[model samples]
Target: MSPPEHRIIAGIYHLSKDLGRHFSLTDINLQVTNGEFVFLVGPSGAGKSTLLRMMYMDDRPDSGQIVVGSFVSTRVTRRTIPGLRRKIGIVFQDFRLIEDRTVFENIALAMKVTGTPMSKIKQRATKILTHVGLYHKRHDFPKALSGGEQQRVAIARAVANRPAILLADEPTGNLDAVSTRNVLELLFKINAGGTAVLVATHDIEMVQSFGQRIIYLENGRIARDHEKIFVGDVRDRMDESRVSRRAEQLSEYDIRDEENE
Candidate 1:
């Protein structure tokens, strides 16, 4: 028998969204697979944010079906939304870190709410901060960091739980040229770690240059899906299975310690 296809992490079928009688998204169909990095490109009001919100189930569609991990939008309830969110991570254009909390505390909040034990949470948080090149500022508050630094914190927090998919909406919007490059590089590193990444941005030049999959949204629909299609790891031809770099595997020392214990 063939292995199960858990690679397809998300799917949208004939989806539509409305904003107070204004239809924001119309008949959108899309899929994101494991270990793949995709770009969602569109101008403002192109429904990029709206589509991301629905994928994470912050809002349900008015006309179609959506699925992330195991929770189907048509079947999931408010009570189940938390569980669904646990399997996915999201970063917004605005650095939504807690203003009152230190950087460490802000990242810790996500793991804490999901019932992560203190020991592992600390280990994972430290490792992820380093991964995003912000370990030196862990003691600082969000306001103390520059805009680029703040976004790095947000990205770190999102992946702290090692979600199966990471959705970032305009993560570079508030950044300058250097900062934008830095943030995008970090995101690619995250993708290399094996978490499927979907970036929603209006940067046509960047998206085109990346040479990865690009799903262009216009008005409220997907006008184009530009990609080089492949089944799985083209490197290891024997096993075409999808691969992922989970959040827990960020630090070899921590993983080894846990195993030794």
Candidate 2:
């Protein structure tokens, strides 16, 4: 008999949060499994990031049972957070790399804090940097690298310790076509490696192109959730004149017809 997969199983039962006297999340429920790549789509102020923070254990829900993997997150003690974090990776919209740290140091810092051996730290950092295609910029500081490069460095740091789940928020925001493709491709590779990835982004077009299991939020509720095929015709005809204006840039990086592996 085979052992169970190390799945990042999540169950948010009636999740809610207090924000200036109102509940940010209104009874949210969700679940995911290993090797699953899920996308979260919603407009600004929609509770996407708040939900992610809860999953990452950064913020506790006001009322609900939140569980990830085998741990109960709702009332998880402070002493156990570090251990829980070791099993999860989180990427932010701000690209939270230390401005003073070089790319290699940024990646190594995660393991260093966890008391990883110095010998293994160097090897692990280098491998993740190469994995994200940032080996050439390993010596550069965050301020010196472009937005996309900095984000890749952030990704390398997140994956350096080999996390079971990765939660990324607006990872491709403000990136050019090429940079977005590169970063998303790196994420796809990570997902292929069996790490569950959940990315929150509002790029509807990109969402349509990537074609993954999506959890769409609206007014603090689960508006839509499913894996759907990318149909360019509907989108193109919805706003014919608008799409025509942006067709050149859109077509350059569109992956609507690409065969999913």
Candidate 3:
């Protein structure tokens, strides 16, 4: 295994949030490793959005800390927040593209704010727009596009900087089934290229089949953190019949253990 410094992408340690009479989050602890894809699932009031905000330091926890790359929430300042945000890509359910800007300008703006040179911005924005299948619509404004196309543009803008981590909150909430699938495929493609993705959604059924790590939040607390297991190819590749039988036995034991618990 790699060292913690090399492996971990984001870490939340004993974080909590208080919204006066109601608690938004309580003692939340979680870690996302470099290049890992994870889902944060819960009901609407489960503080999923709050946690994502905290991770990006748009809001700070009442206690404890959040560490993303080398930026620490406790130590980060107003002037440095933009610097931290540059390392993270954030996507929202609502397509937040500027109505007046063209698709190309929307993406280019992300790079521009970071002082990326005009030539490099044009090259990177063009490449990202092509990747998202929106190159043809580069000159079109947001109001001229459909909901799905607009979301794709939003995603393109989010990743224009090639951030280390991507935090998406209900990215598919407003899309139809087909559009949702297309958006998810885009996210998977981004993840495959080595960006750590932490997507927060209330639709468990939509993401469960992907076989990635899932953390379940309920009432501002983590109810379960489940990791994926590989049983398909490993089971089929067993050298001997007895070994296969042994694997089956172990599987049975695991099931029984879960039932007992």
Candidate 4:
């Protein structure tokens, strides 16, 4: 196993809502190692988004702590939060691109805020836009692109700084099947390049075939955390009917049984 510096560690964390009427999340403990691709899956209100937020330091845990690289939640201050965020990339379900900015500018802005040199910003932004297959539309505003294209640009912006970890929340929620596949493929490609990727989503059928580590969240707690086992090429299992059948099989496993209990 790698040392703590190479992992995202959450230590017995807890959080609640509505003045403690109910716990939004509790007893959460997990670690994401550098360059690993993992999925955080659960139904809505399962605290998936909240966990991501805490990892990035957007919100602090009510108890315990989270450590991302060298930054520790127990020691982080407002003045240092930006420094921590620069080491992590974040993507949202809704395309959060600035409507008024061109695709190139949207990506460049991310680099610019981090004080990247202008020459390098132009160079990196162009490379990322081309990598995402949207260089041709670099001058177009967000509204000018299709939904899939917009999401690709959002991904480009998210990773513009080359962060060590990328957190994506429900990245395919609004896309049609084809677009969803495309966006997920892009994420896989990025992960292959050695950036740790953690994606949160409620759509289990879309991700079960990938054979990656999956941490199942239910009622604000982790129900299961383990790598999935699949036979043959994962791509071969991606057909709709096959994935649906696999999902059915998974429901009989411990994760689903715990959910029922």
Q: Pick the candidate with the highest TM-score.
A: 3
RMSD of every prediction? 11.6, 7.5, 10.3, 7.3
- The sequence of per-residue lDDT tens digits that candidate 4 reaches over residues 90-195 is 8988989999999999999999889999999999988999999999999999999989899999999989999888999999887755567778878878987878
* Candidate 1: tens digits of C-alpha lDDT, residues 1-261: 986455789999999887555647889999999978999999987889889999999988998999898999999998999999988989988989999999999999999999999999999998999898889999999999999899999999999889999999999887765567667778878887889999999878655655679999987889999984644433332122111121223245456878999
Ranking by lDDT: 3, 1, 4, 2
Question: In model 2, where do residues sit more than 4 Å from their true spots?
Answer: 1-8, 21-23, 228-261
What tens-digit string does per-residue lDDT give for candidate 3 at 104-197?
Answer: 9999999999999999999998899999999999999999998878989998999999999999999988875556766777887888788889
Model 2 compared with the native: what TM-score? 0.84
Give me the runs in candidate 4 sitting further than 4 Å from their true place.
Answer: 1-21, 228-261
Q: Global lDDT of each model? A: 0.84, 0.78, 0.85, 0.81
Candidates 1 and 2, the one with greater TM-score: 1
Report the number of clashing residue pairs per model. 2, 0, 0, 0
Best by lDDT: 3
Q: Could you tell me every candidate's TM-score relative to the true structure?
A: 0.84, 0.84, 0.85, 0.84
lDDT of 4 at 218: 82
In model 3, state the lDDT of residue 223.
91
| lDDT (tens digit, per residue) of candidate 2 on 182-209 | 6777787898787888899876666655
